[model samples]
Target: MKNKLFLSLALFFCATNIMLSQNIEIKDDKVLVDGKEILKYEKINFFQHSFYSLTDDEEILMYKYNDNESREYKEDDYFILNFLTAKKKIECGDIQKVVTGLGMSSKKNMEKLITWLLKEKVIDVNGILNTNKLDTFYEKYNENITERTIR
Candidate 1:
């Protein structure tokens, strides 16, 4: 009975890890998944200074993942979401940090987030998530004030 329990537990862990695993890479100012570009970036020049403009969405995603009070997803999950939904450019390595209980968020809060997105029509009922729809959803709901909005 004990051996059966241990085997079951091992299989569960392996399956969970497989489900959450993602290959995240940044190349040539683009965020890539499995060598396919998922996001692109353009360098910003400010007179003598030049830098990339990071998006509010990117920052908030990291905040939600790193803040102990709100931390409920793995970095990879946050990374993909940010890449898909952010209107502004982001550097993948900018917010990387040591995370405890890395995959702990996979089951609960992650599911809740997905469910809410689906209900809001941000995500479709299809098995595969549509990245363009994700972007549209973020743009529709994001609350960052812009100069155009002020007028």
Candidate 2:
């Protein structure tokens, strides 16, 4: 009976560790994995590491517009605007300007718009803004202009 109980407890601990490893939370500029806040030194390094891992060239290609399909840039514009507003916590006004600068006019064409920007060399892989920055909003609430998307 004691051996069975010990085995059950070990299994429970292993399952708990697996669950804790998958999700990350941000609050007050601190990163939490499971319930514990990661140390400051680890936080920045971890963020940088994750950021580098997420952004890649192929992901950028997926958002490009295909003119042969008659896709409009507006669709992409609105998509980007909404994404930026939600992810960066930026004002709608600011997002509009950024979207316009990218030649995107509609939310529906966001995919194509982003692709065009990348193809035109207007926005490089590192230059394109990332919407996932919203994940860190609870911590810093600061807008990051340099964030890029990851596939």
Q: lDDT value for candidate 2?
A: 0.33
> Taking the tens digit of each residue's C-alpha lDDT, what string does model 1 give over 38-96?
33333232101111223321221221332222356433222223433344422222222
Q: Which ten residues in a row are the worst by lDDT in model 1?
A: 44-53
Candidate 1: stretches off by over 4 Å: 43-132, 135-151
Question: What does candidate 2's lDDT look like per residue over 1-151, in tens digits?
Answer: 9999999999999999877443333344333434454311112231011111123322221111112222454332212122222333321212333233444433323323333333444333434443343343223332332254232
Task: State candidate 2's TM-score.
Answer: 0.18
Provide the RMSD of all predictions against the true structure, rounded to 1 decimal. Answer: 12.5, 17.7
